[model samples]
Target: MAEYRLKTPLSNEDVEKLKSGDIVYLSGTMYTARDAAHKRLVDLILNGEELPFELEGAVIYYVGPTPPKPGEPIGSAGPTTSYRMDPYAPILIEHGLKGMIGKGKRNQDVKDACVKYKAVYFGATGGAAALIAKAIKKAEVIAYPELGPEAVRRIEVEDFPVVVVNDTFGNDLYDEGRKLWEKK
Candidate 1:
Protein backbone atom coordinates (compact mmCIF):
# COMPACT_ATOMS: atom_id res chain seq x y z
CA MET A 1 0.00 0.00 0.00
CA ALA A 2 2.97 2.29 0.27
CA GLU A 3 6.10 3.00 -1.74
CA TYR A 4 9.50 2.98 -0.16
CA ARG A 5 13.05 3.77 -1.21
CA LEU A 6 15.34 1.13 0.26
CA LYS A 7 19.08 0.75 0.43
CA THR A 8 20.98 -2.52 0.39
CA PRO A 9 22.12 -4.49 3.41
CA LEU A 10 18.69 -3.95 4.87
CA SER A 11 18.02 -4.71 8.50
CA ASN A 12 15.36 -7.05 9.88
CA GLU A 13 13.44 -3.98 10.96
CA ASP A 14 13.61 -2.61 7.41
CA VAL A 15 12.33 -5.85 5.93
CA GLU A 16 9.58 -6.24 8.52
CA LYS A 17 8.17 -2.89 7.50
CA LEU A 18 7.45 -3.95 3.92
CA LYS A 19 4.20 -5.60 2.84
CA SER A 20 3.16 -7.58 -0.21
CA GLY A 21 2.37 -5.26 -3.14
CA ASP A 22 4.41 -2.37 -1.87
CA ILE A 23 6.51 -0.68 -4.50
CA VAL A 24 10.18 -0.35 -3.74
CA TYR A 25 13.05 1.47 -5.39
CA LEU A 26 16.18 -0.09 -4.02
CA SER A 27 19.60 1.55 -4.05
CA GLY A 28 23.05 0.63 -2.77
CA THR A 29 24.71 -2.75 -3.19
CA MET A 30 23.01 -6.01 -4.15
CA TYR A 31 24.43 -9.29 -5.32
CA THR A 32 23.44 -11.16 -8.48
CA ALA A 33 23.38 -14.93 -8.17
CA ARG A 34 21.31 -17.24 -10.29
CA ASP A 35 20.96 -21.02 -9.82
CA ALA A 36 24.58 -21.97 -10.38
CA ALA A 37 25.98 -19.19 -8.26
CA HIS A 38 23.51 -19.91 -5.48
CA LYS A 39 24.53 -23.57 -5.35
CA ARG A 40 28.18 -22.58 -5.16
CA LEU A 41 27.51 -20.08 -2.40
CA VAL A 42 25.67 -22.69 -0.36
CA ASP A 43 28.42 -25.19 -0.89
CA LEU A 44 30.90 -22.69 0.44
CA ILE A 45 28.78 -22.26 3.53
CA LEU A 46 28.28 -26.00 4.13
CA ASN A 47 31.99 -26.63 3.74
CA GLY A 48 32.85 -23.89 6.25
CA GLU A 49 34.73 -21.89 3.65
CA GLU A 50 34.68 -18.14 3.60
CA LEU A 51 32.09 -16.80 1.16
CA PRO A 52 33.32 -14.44 -1.51
CA PHE A 53 31.00 -11.78 -0.22
CA GLU A 54 29.40 -11.01 3.10
CA LEU A 55 25.92 -12.42 3.57
CA GLU A 56 24.71 -10.48 6.58
CA GLY A 57 21.92 -8.08 5.66
CA ALA A 58 22.59 -8.64 1.99
CA VAL A 59 20.10 -8.69 -0.86
CA ILE A 60 20.61 -11.17 -3.70
CA TYR A 61 19.04 -10.67 -7.08
CA TYR A 62 18.30 -13.80 -9.12
CA VAL A 63 19.64 -12.95 -12.54
CA GLY A 64 21.97 -14.17 -15.24
CA PRO A 65 22.69 -10.98 -17.09
CA THR A 66 23.61 -10.76 -20.75
CA PRO A 67 27.18 -9.77 -21.57
CA PRO A 68 27.44 -6.05 -21.59
CA LYS A 69 28.36 -4.15 -24.69
CA PRO A 70 31.52 -2.11 -24.59
CA GLY A 71 31.33 0.66 -21.98
CA GLU A 72 28.25 -0.64 -20.15
CA PRO A 73 28.18 -1.95 -16.62
CA ILE A 74 25.53 -4.60 -17.42
CA GLY A 75 23.19 -5.57 -20.20
CA SER A 76 19.64 -6.81 -20.25
CA ALA A 77 19.73 -7.46 -16.53
CA GLY A 78 16.48 -9.35 -16.32
CA PRO A 79 15.31 -11.34 -13.34
CA THR A 80 15.41 -15.10 -13.61
CA THR A 81 12.63 -17.33 -12.37
CA SER A 82 12.98 -17.39 -8.62
CA TYR A 83 11.95 -21.01 -8.18
CA ARG A 84 15.19 -22.19 -9.69
CA MET A 85 16.98 -20.68 -6.73
CA ASP A 86 14.49 -21.99 -4.14
CA PRO A 87 16.55 -25.03 -3.21
CA TYR A 88 19.38 -22.80 -2.05
CA ALA A 89 17.45 -19.76 -0.86
CA PRO A 90 16.43 -20.91 2.58
CA ILE A 91 19.98 -21.86 3.40
CA LEU A 92 21.16 -18.41 2.47
CA ILE A 93 18.25 -16.84 4.36
CA GLU A 94 19.19 -18.73 7.50
CA HIS A 95 22.62 -17.20 7.20
CA GLY A 96 21.31 -13.58 7.28
CA LEU A 97 20.32 -12.80 3.68
CA LYS A 98 17.63 -10.17 4.01
CA GLY A 99 16.08 -9.97 0.55
CA MET A 100 15.83 -11.55 -2.92
CA ILE A 101 14.84 -9.98 -6.23
CA GLY A 102 13.53 -12.13 -9.01
CA LYS A 103 10.51 -13.08 -11.07
CA GLY A 104 7.72 -15.69 -10.72
CA LYS A 105 6.55 -17.69 -7.72
CA ARG A 106 8.62 -19.23 -4.97
CA ASN A 107 7.74 -22.41 -3.09
CA GLN A 108 6.15 -22.52 0.36
CA ASP A 109 9.43 -23.29 2.03
CA VAL A 110 10.91 -20.14 0.57
CA LYS A 111 7.96 -18.15 1.87
CA ASP A 112 8.33 -19.79 5.25
CA ALA A 113 11.98 -18.78 5.30
CA CYS A 114 11.00 -15.21 4.55
CA VAL A 115 8.58 -15.16 7.45
CA LYS A 116 10.80 -16.98 9.89
CA TYR A 117 13.90 -14.99 9.08
CA LYS A 118 12.22 -11.64 8.69
CA ALA A 119 13.28 -11.34 5.07
CA VAL A 120 11.42 -10.32 1.92
CA TYR A 121 11.12 -11.39 -1.73
CA PHE A 122 10.96 -8.65 -4.31
CA GLY A 123 9.75 -9.08 -7.93
CA ALA A 124 11.27 -7.25 -10.84
CA THR A 125 9.36 -6.96 -14.09
CA GLY A 126 10.40 -10.00 -16.04
CA GLY A 127 10.64 -8.41 -19.47
CA ALA A 128 12.08 -5.12 -18.37
CA ALA A 129 15.72 -6.08 -18.38
CA ALA A 130 16.98 -3.27 -20.55
CA LEU A 131 15.30 -0.72 -18.36
CA ILE A 132 16.62 -2.42 -15.26
CA ALA A 133 20.15 -2.32 -16.58
CA LYS A 134 20.10 1.44 -16.52
CA ALA A 135 19.75 1.39 -12.74
CA ILE A 136 22.92 -0.61 -12.24
CA LYS A 137 25.70 1.91 -11.84
CA LYS A 138 28.50 -0.60 -11.43
CA ALA A 139 29.05 -4.35 -11.72
CA GLU A 140 31.97 -6.57 -11.01
CA VAL A 141 32.11 -10.33 -11.01
CA ILE A 142 32.97 -11.45 -7.52
CA ALA A 143 33.26 -15.20 -8.14
CA TYR A 144 32.74 -18.10 -10.54
CA PRO A 145 33.62 -16.11 -13.60
CA GLU A 146 33.58 -19.41 -15.49
CA LEU A 147 29.86 -19.50 -15.03
CA GLY A 148 29.67 -16.56 -17.45
CA PRO A 149 26.27 -15.00 -17.14
CA GLU A 150 25.57 -17.06 -14.04
CA ALA A 151 28.64 -15.62 -12.39
CA VAL A 152 28.01 -13.91 -9.08
CA ARG A 153 28.38 -10.18 -9.45
CA ARG A 154 28.36 -7.40 -6.92
CA ILE A 155 26.39 -4.47 -8.31
CA GLU A 156 25.63 -0.99 -7.14
CA VAL A 157 22.19 0.29 -8.04
CA GLU A 158 20.34 3.54 -7.86
CA ASP A 159 16.59 3.40 -7.44
CA PHE A 160 16.30 -0.11 -8.82
CA PRO A 161 12.58 -0.75 -9.14
CA VAL A 162 10.83 -3.79 -7.71
CA VAL A 163 7.60 -4.87 -6.05
CA VAL A 164 7.13 -6.71 -2.79
CA VAL A 165 5.96 -10.17 -3.78
CA ASN A 166 6.46 -11.90 -0.45
CA ASP A 167 6.72 -10.12 2.87
CA THR A 168 7.96 -11.09 6.30
CA PHE A 169 4.37 -11.13 7.50
CA GLY A 170 3.65 -14.17 5.24
CA ASN A 171 1.60 -12.31 2.64
CA ASP A 172 2.10 -13.16 -1.03
CA LEU A 173 1.21 -10.54 -3.60
CA TYR A 174 0.79 -13.05 -6.44
CA ASP A 175 -1.74 -15.02 -4.40
CA GLU A 176 -3.44 -11.97 -2.95
CA GLY A 177 -3.84 -10.31 -6.32
CA ARG A 178 -5.14 -13.52 -7.85
CA LYS A 179 -7.78 -13.80 -5.17
CA LEU A 180 -8.90 -10.26 -5.79
CA TRP A 181 -9.01 -10.42 -9.60
CA GLU A 182 -10.32 -13.91 -10.22
CA LYS A 183 -13.78 -14.08 -11.68
CA LYS A 184 -16.41 -14.62 -9.00
Candidate 2:
Protein backbone atom coordinates (compact mmCIF):
# COMPACT_ATOMS: atom_id res chain seq x y z
CA MET A 1 0.00 0.00 0.00
CA ALA A 2 1.09 3.53 -0.72
CA GLU A 3 0.08 6.98 0.47
CA TYR A 4 -1.18 9.69 -1.88
CA ARG A 5 -2.27 13.29 -1.51
CA LEU A 6 -4.63 13.98 -4.39
CA LYS A 7 -6.71 16.88 -5.61
CA THR A 8 -10.27 16.41 -6.85
CA PRO A 9 -11.29 16.02 -10.48
CA LEU A 10 -8.92 13.08 -10.39
CA SER A 11 -7.52 11.82 -13.63
CA ASN A 12 -7.46 8.24 -14.87
CA GLU A 13 -3.71 8.28 -14.46
CA ASP A 14 -4.11 9.31 -10.83
CA VAL A 15 -6.62 6.53 -10.13
CA GLU A 16 -4.64 3.86 -11.96
CA LYS A 17 -1.69 4.42 -9.67
CA LEU A 18 -3.74 3.62 -6.55
CA LYS A 19 -4.15 0.13 -5.10
CA SER A 20 -6.41 -1.37 -2.47
CA GLY A 21 -5.34 -0.56 1.09
CA ASP A 22 -3.53 2.62 0.10
CA ILE A 23 -4.08 5.76 2.18
CA VAL A 24 -5.29 8.91 0.46
CA TYR A 25 -5.67 12.46 1.67
CA LEU A 26 -7.81 14.30 -0.83
CA SER A 27 -7.90 18.07 -1.24
CA GLY A 28 -9.75 20.46 -3.52
CA THR A 29 -13.31 20.00 -4.75
CA MET A 30 -15.68 17.09 -4.34
CA TYR A 31 -19.44 16.78 -4.52
CA THR A 32 -21.67 15.44 -1.77
CA ALA A 33 -24.48 13.16 -2.92
CA ARG A 34 -26.69 10.61 -1.29
CA ASP A 35 -29.23 8.31 -2.96
CA ALA A 36 -31.76 10.95 -3.89
CA ALA A 37 -29.09 13.17 -5.42
CA HIS A 38 -27.59 10.25 -7.31
CA LYS A 39 -30.92 9.26 -8.77
CA ARG A 40 -31.49 12.82 -9.94
CA LEU A 41 -28.11 12.91 -11.65
CA VAL A 42 -28.73 9.59 -13.34
CA ASP A 43 -32.14 10.76 -14.47
CA LEU A 44 -30.55 13.77 -16.10
CA ILE A 45 -28.18 11.48 -17.99
CA LEU A 46 -30.96 9.21 -19.19
CA ASN A 47 -33.01 12.17 -20.30
CA GLY A 48 -30.11 13.61 -22.31
CA GLU A 49 -30.33 16.78 -20.29
CA GLU A 50 -27.54 18.84 -18.82
CA LEU A 51 -26.15 17.86 -15.45
CA PRO A 52 -25.57 20.43 -12.72
CA PHE A 53 -21.97 19.40 -12.29
CA GLU A 54 -19.46 18.10 -14.80
CA LEU A 55 -18.92 14.37 -14.64
CA GLU A 56 -15.42 14.09 -16.00
CA GLY A 57 -12.84 13.28 -13.36
CA ALA A 58 -15.25 14.24 -10.59
CA VAL A 59 -15.29 12.72 -7.12
CA ILE A 60 -18.63 12.16 -5.37
CA TYR A 61 -18.70 11.70 -1.64
CA TYR A 62 -21.75 9.86 -0.24
CA VAL A 63 -22.84 11.94 2.72
CA GLY A 64 -25.78 13.88 4.17
CA PRO A 65 -24.52 16.30 6.76
CA THR A 66 -26.29 17.96 9.61
CA PRO A 67 -26.87 21.73 9.65
CA PRO A 68 -23.71 23.54 10.53
CA LYS A 69 -23.08 25.53 13.69
CA PRO A 70 -21.96 29.11 13.53
CA GLY A 71 -18.59 29.70 11.84
CA GLU A 72 -18.48 26.20 10.30
CA PRO A 73 -18.92 25.11 6.73
CA ILE A 74 -20.60 21.80 7.60
CA GLY A 75 -21.54 19.54 10.46
CA SER A 76 -21.10 15.82 11.17
CA ALA A 77 -20.28 15.02 7.59
CA GLY A 78 -19.41 11.34 7.48
CA PRO A 79 -19.94 8.79 4.75
CA THR A 80 -23.30 7.12 4.26
CA THR A 81 -23.80 3.46 3.35
CA SER A 82 -22.38 3.06 -0.15
CA TYR A 83 -24.65 0.25 -1.28
CA ARG A 84 -27.49 2.70 -1.89
CA MET A 85 -25.49 4.32 -4.66
CA ASP A 86 -24.44 1.10 -6.40
CA PRO A 87 -27.39 1.03 -8.76
CA TYR A 88 -26.53 4.44 -10.15
CA ALA A 89 -22.74 4.28 -9.87
CA PRO A 90 -21.98 2.35 -13.03
CA ILE A 91 -23.91 4.83 -15.11
CA LEU A 92 -22.00 7.74 -13.57
CA ILE A 93 -18.69 5.92 -13.94
CA GLU A 94 -19.37 5.45 -17.63
CA HIS A 95 -19.77 9.20 -17.87
CA GLY A 96 -16.25 9.92 -16.50
CA LEU A 97 -16.72 9.89 -12.75
CA LYS A 98 -13.29 9.03 -11.33
CA GLY A 99 -13.77 8.43 -7.65
CA MET A 100 -16.36 7.73 -4.94
CA ILE A 101 -15.94 8.09 -1.20
CA GLY A 102 -18.32 6.12 0.96
CA LYS A 103 -18.67 3.25 3.41
CA GLY A 104 -19.64 -0.45 3.00
CA LYS A 105 -19.35 -2.92 0.14
CA ARG A 106 -20.29 -2.14 -3.40
CA ASN A 107 -21.97 -4.66 -5.68
CA GLN A 108 -20.20 -6.60 -8.43
CA ASP A 109 -21.44 -4.28 -11.15
CA VAL A 110 -19.97 -1.29 -9.35
CA LYS A 111 -16.62 -3.05 -8.97
CA ASP A 112 -16.71 -4.07 -12.61
CA ALA A 113 -17.42 -0.46 -13.56
CA CYS A 114 -14.43 0.71 -11.54
CA VAL A 115 -12.14 -1.69 -13.41
CA LYS A 116 -13.59 -0.87 -16.81
CA TYR A 117 -13.49 2.87 -16.32
CA LYS A 118 -10.19 3.19 -14.48
CA ALA A 119 -11.89 4.57 -11.38
CA VAL A 120 -11.49 3.87 -7.68
CA TYR A 121 -13.63 3.68 -4.51
CA PHE A 122 -12.31 4.96 -1.23
CA GLY A 123 -13.73 4.11 2.18
CA ALA A 124 -14.13 6.71 4.89
CA THR A 125 -14.18 5.65 8.49
CA GLY A 126 -17.73 5.28 9.80
CA GLY A 127 -18.91 7.10 12.94
CA ALA A 128 -16.25 9.73 12.55
CA ALA A 129 -18.45 12.53 11.29
CA ALA A 130 -17.20 15.20 13.63
CA LEU A 131 -13.62 14.46 12.80
CA ILE A 132 -14.35 14.32 9.10
CA ALA A 133 -16.22 17.63 9.06
CA LYS A 134 -13.05 19.40 10.11
CA ALA A 135 -11.58 18.78 6.66
CA ILE A 136 -14.46 20.45 4.85
CA LYS A 137 -13.57 24.11 4.60
CA LYS A 138 -16.34 25.26 2.30
CA ALA A 139 -19.71 24.05 1.00
CA GLU A 140 -22.36 25.37 -1.33
CA VAL A 141 -25.48 23.75 -2.66
CA ILE A 142 -25.22 23.43 -6.40
CA ALA A 143 -28.43 21.50 -7.12
CA TYR A 144 -31.64 20.02 -5.69
CA PRO A 145 -31.84 22.31 -2.71
CA GLU A 146 -35.27 20.84 -2.01
CA LEU A 147 -33.65 17.66 -0.83
CA GLY A 148 -32.15 19.62 2.06
CA PRO A 149 -29.28 17.61 3.51
CA GLU A 150 -29.46 15.23 0.60
CA ALA A 151 -28.99 18.04 -1.88
CA VAL A 152 -25.95 18.03 -4.14
CA ARG A 153 -23.31 20.30 -2.69
CA ARG A 154 -19.95 21.28 -4.03
CA ILE A 155 -17.43 21.22 -1.24
CA GLU A 156 -13.81 22.10 -0.75
CA VAL A 157 -11.77 19.82 1.42
CA GLU A 158 -8.26 19.81 2.77
CA ASP A 159 -6.47 16.60 3.61
CA PHE A 160 -9.65 14.52 3.74
CA PRO A 161 -8.49 11.03 4.69
CA VAL A 162 -9.70 7.79 3.15
CA VAL A 163 -8.53 4.26 2.40
CA VAL A 164 -8.64 2.67 -1.02
CA VAL A 165 -11.24 -0.08 -0.69
CA ASN A 166 -11.66 -0.84 -4.37
CA ASP A 167 -8.98 0.11 -6.86
CA THR A 168 -8.94 0.21 -10.63
CA PHE A 169 -7.00 -3.05 -10.52
CA GLY A 170 -10.00 -4.88 -8.94
CA ASN A 171 -8.53 -5.36 -5.48
CA ASP A 172 -11.04 -5.04 -2.59
CA LEU A 173 -9.56 -4.19 0.76
CA TYR A 174 -12.51 -5.45 2.84
CA ASP A 175 -12.36 -8.85 1.18
CA GLU A 176 -8.58 -9.07 1.30
CA GLY A 177 -8.41 -7.94 4.89
CA ARG A 178 -11.15 -10.36 5.93
CA LYS A 179 -9.35 -13.27 4.30
CA LEU A 180 -6.18 -12.44 6.16
CA TRP A 181 -7.95 -12.33 9.52
CA GLU A 182 -10.07 -15.40 8.95
CA LYS A 183 -9.10 -18.50 10.95
CA LYS A 184 -9.33 -22.07 9.68
Candidate 3:
Protein backbone atom coordinates (compact mmCIF):
# COMPACT_ATOMS: atom_id res chain seq x y z
CA MET A 1 0.00 0.00 0.00
CA ALA A 2 2.90 2.37 -0.57
CA GLU A 3 1.82 5.68 -2.05
CA TYR A 4 3.62 7.95 -4.55
CA ARG A 5 2.89 11.52 -5.53
CA LEU A 6 4.31 12.53 -8.87
CA LYS A 7 5.15 16.21 -8.85
CA THR A 8 7.49 15.90 -11.78
CA PRO A 9 7.93 13.37 -14.53
CA LEU A 10 9.09 10.05 -13.08
CA SER A 11 12.43 8.62 -13.99
CA ASN A 12 13.07 5.10 -15.24
CA GLU A 13 14.67 4.25 -11.94
CA ASP A 14 11.58 5.52 -10.18
CA VAL A 15 9.36 3.39 -12.39
CA GLU A 16 11.38 0.20 -11.85
CA LYS A 17 11.29 0.60 -8.09
CA LEU A 18 7.58 -0.06 -8.30
CA LYS A 19 6.40 -3.68 -8.31
CA SER A 20 3.18 -5.49 -9.06
CA GLY A 21 0.24 -4.82 -6.71
CA ASP A 22 1.84 -1.61 -5.41
CA ILE A 23 -0.61 1.20 -4.89
CA VAL A 24 0.21 4.47 -6.68
CA TYR A 25 -1.27 7.85 -5.85
CA LEU A 26 -0.31 10.00 -8.81
CA SER A 27 -0.80 13.73 -8.74
CA GLY A 28 0.70 16.99 -10.06
CA THR A 29 -0.27 16.27 -13.69
CA MET A 30 -1.39 13.46 -16.01
CA TYR A 31 -2.58 13.47 -19.60
CA THR A 32 -5.46 11.32 -20.83
CA ALA A 33 -5.13 9.82 -24.29
CA ARG A 34 -6.97 6.96 -25.96
CA ASP A 35 -6.56 5.17 -29.30
CA ALA A 36 -7.32 8.17 -31.49
CA ALA A 37 -5.30 10.48 -29.36
CA HIS A 38 -2.32 8.17 -29.54
CA LYS A 39 -2.51 8.15 -33.30
CA ARG A 40 -2.65 11.93 -33.47
CA LEU A 41 0.19 12.29 -30.98
CA VAL A 42 2.47 10.02 -32.93
CA ASP A 43 1.55 11.84 -36.09
CA LEU A 44 2.55 15.09 -34.49
CA ILE A 45 5.95 13.64 -33.81
CA LEU A 46 6.29 12.36 -37.33
CA ASN A 47 5.41 15.77 -38.71
CA GLY A 48 7.74 17.58 -36.30
CA GLU A 49 4.88 19.50 -34.72
CA GLU A 50 5.37 20.41 -31.10
CA LEU A 51 3.47 18.26 -28.64
CA PRO A 52 0.74 19.82 -26.57
CA PHE A 53 2.51 18.72 -23.41
CA GLU A 54 5.86 17.51 -22.28
CA LEU A 55 6.21 13.74 -22.28
CA GLU A 56 9.35 13.28 -20.29
CA GLY A 57 8.47 10.98 -17.44
CA ALA A 58 4.85 11.57 -18.37
CA VAL A 59 2.19 8.94 -17.83
CA ILE A 60 -0.47 8.55 -20.50
CA TYR A 61 -3.72 6.84 -19.56
CA TYR A 62 -5.64 4.99 -22.27
CA VAL A 63 -9.34 5.55 -21.89
CA GLY A 64 -12.43 6.40 -23.94
CA PRO A 65 -15.45 6.77 -21.74
CA THR A 66 -19.06 7.79 -21.57
CA PRO A 67 -19.93 11.45 -21.16
CA PRO A 68 -19.86 12.68 -17.62
CA LYS A 69 -23.06 13.36 -15.75
CA PRO A 70 -23.84 17.10 -15.64
CA GLY A 71 -22.02 17.84 -12.37
CA GLU A 72 -19.22 15.33 -12.76
CA PRO A 73 -15.97 16.11 -14.54
CA ILE A 74 -15.55 12.60 -15.92
CA GLY A 75 -17.59 9.45 -16.32
CA SER A 76 -16.82 5.77 -15.95
CA ALA A 77 -13.22 6.13 -17.00
CA GLY A 78 -11.28 2.88 -16.72
CA PRO A 79 -8.17 1.43 -18.21
CA THR A 80 -8.76 0.39 -21.80
CA THR A 81 -6.93 -2.37 -23.66
CA SER A 82 -3.29 -1.30 -24.02
CA TYR A 83 -2.41 -3.30 -27.11
CA ARG A 84 -4.00 -0.78 -29.42
CA MET A 85 -1.52 1.87 -28.41
CA ASP A 86 1.53 -0.35 -28.80
CA PRO A 87 2.54 0.73 -32.29
CA TYR A 88 2.93 4.37 -31.35
CA ALA A 89 4.37 3.77 -27.89
CA PRO A 90 7.91 3.16 -29.03
CA ILE A 91 8.00 6.58 -30.61
CA LEU A 92 6.57 8.18 -27.53
CA ILE A 93 9.08 6.36 -25.34
CA GLU A 94 11.83 7.70 -27.53
CA HIS A 95 10.42 11.17 -27.06
CA GLY A 96 10.75 10.93 -23.26
CA LEU A 97 7.42 9.44 -22.29
CA LYS A 98 8.17 7.50 -19.14
CA GLY A 99 4.95 5.88 -18.02
CA MET A 100 1.70 4.62 -19.51
CA ILE A 101 -1.49 3.57 -17.68
CA GLY A 102 -3.78 1.04 -19.27
CA LYS A 103 -4.78 -2.63 -19.10
CA GLY A 104 -3.69 -5.82 -20.89
CA LYS A 105 -0.70 -6.97 -22.93
CA ARG A 106 1.80 -4.88 -24.93
CA ASN A 107 4.03 -5.64 -27.89
CA GLN A 108 7.72 -6.53 -27.60
CA ASP A 109 8.79 -3.12 -28.98
CA VAL A 110 6.96 -1.40 -26.21
CA LYS A 111 8.80 -3.65 -23.79
CA ASP A 112 12.03 -2.97 -25.60
CA ALA A 113 11.38 0.75 -25.30
CA CYS A 114 10.88 0.27 -21.59
CA VAL A 115 14.32 -1.28 -21.41
CA LYS A 116 15.95 1.19 -23.75
CA TYR A 117 14.53 4.38 -22.30
CA LYS A 118 13.97 3.26 -18.74
CA ALA A 119 10.22 3.71 -18.98
CA VAL A 120 7.47 1.70 -17.32
CA TYR A 121 4.04 0.53 -18.44
CA PHE A 122 1.47 0.41 -15.69
CA GLY A 123 -1.86 -1.41 -15.61
CA ALA A 124 -4.96 -0.32 -13.78
CA THR A 125 -7.65 -2.91 -13.24
CA GLY A 126 -9.98 -3.49 -16.18
CA GLY A 127 -13.77 -3.58 -15.69
CA ALA A 128 -13.45 -1.51 -12.53
CA ALA A 129 -14.74 1.71 -13.99
CA ALA A 130 -16.64 2.97 -10.98
CA LEU A 131 -13.88 2.14 -8.55
CA ILE A 132 -11.15 3.53 -10.73
CA ALA A 133 -13.03 6.72 -11.47
CA LYS A 134 -12.92 7.53 -7.80
CA ALA A 135 -9.18 8.07 -8.08
CA ILE A 136 -9.66 10.93 -10.52
CA LYS A 137 -10.36 14.17 -8.72
CA LYS A 138 -10.56 16.70 -11.54
CA ALA A 139 -10.54 16.70 -15.32
CA GLU A 140 -10.27 19.22 -18.14
CA VAL A 141 -9.78 18.84 -21.83
CA ILE A 142 -6.37 20.02 -22.99
CA ALA A 143 -6.52 19.02 -26.65
CA TYR A 144 -8.66 17.75 -29.48
CA PRO A 145 -12.08 18.55 -28.17
CA GLU A 146 -13.53 17.80 -31.58
CA LEU A 147 -12.42 14.20 -31.27
CA GLY A 148 -15.01 13.54 -28.60
CA PRO A 149 -13.98 10.44 -26.66
CA GLU A 150 -10.53 10.75 -28.13
CA ALA A 151 -9.90 14.15 -26.60
CA VAL A 152 -6.86 14.58 -24.37
CA ARG A 153 -7.38 15.73 -20.83
CA ARG A 154 -5.47 16.89 -17.83
CA ILE A 155 -6.63 14.98 -14.81
CA GLU A 156 -5.80 15.07 -11.14
CA VAL A 157 -5.90 11.78 -9.33
CA GLU A 158 -5.50 10.79 -5.71
CA ASP A 159 -4.59 7.34 -4.46
CA PHE A 160 -4.63 5.92 -7.95
CA PRO A 161 -3.79 2.22 -7.75
CA VAL A 162 -1.69 0.73 -10.53
CA VAL A 163 0.57 -2.26 -11.11
CA VAL A 164 3.85 -2.19 -12.96
CA VAL A 165 3.38 -4.32 -16.06
CA ASN A 166 6.64 -3.81 -17.92
CA ASP A 167 9.82 -2.72 -16.19
CA THR A 168 12.76 -0.88 -17.70
CA PHE A 169 14.78 -4.06 -17.44
CA GLY A 170 12.29 -5.97 -19.59
CA ASN A 171 10.48 -7.90 -16.90
CA ASP A 172 6.77 -8.45 -17.52
CA LEU A 173 5.02 -9.10 -14.28
CA TYR A 174 1.71 -9.82 -15.98
CA ASP A 175 3.03 -13.01 -17.56
CA GLU A 176 5.40 -13.96 -14.79
CA GLY A 177 2.97 -13.18 -12.02
CA ARG A 178 0.17 -15.13 -13.64
CA LYS A 179 2.39 -18.07 -14.42
CA LEU A 180 3.50 -18.20 -10.83
CA TRP A 181 -0.10 -18.35 -9.70
CA GLU A 182 -1.02 -20.87 -12.38
CA LYS A 183 1.72 -23.23 -11.22
CA LYS A 184 0.09 -23.47 -7.83
Provide the lowest-lDDT 10-residue window in model 3: 1-10
Stretches of candidate 2 above 4 Å error? none
Kindly list the per-residue Cα lDDT of model 3 for residues 1-184, writing each as its tens digit.
Answer: 2556554468766876766555666665788998889999999999999998998889898988678999887999998999999989999999999889999999999999888887888889899998888888888999999999889998887777787778777888778878878953
Pairing residues by index, what is the TM-score of model 2?
0.99
Estimated TM-score for each candidate: 0.98, 0.99, 0.91
Write model 2 residue lDDT over 20-45, tens digit each, in one string.
99999999999999999999999999
**Distance (Å) between predicted and true CA of 118, model 1?**
0.8
Candidate 3 colliding pairs, count: 0
Note the Cα lDDT for every prediction shown: 0.95, 0.96, 0.84
What order do candidates take by lDDT, descending?
2, 1, 3
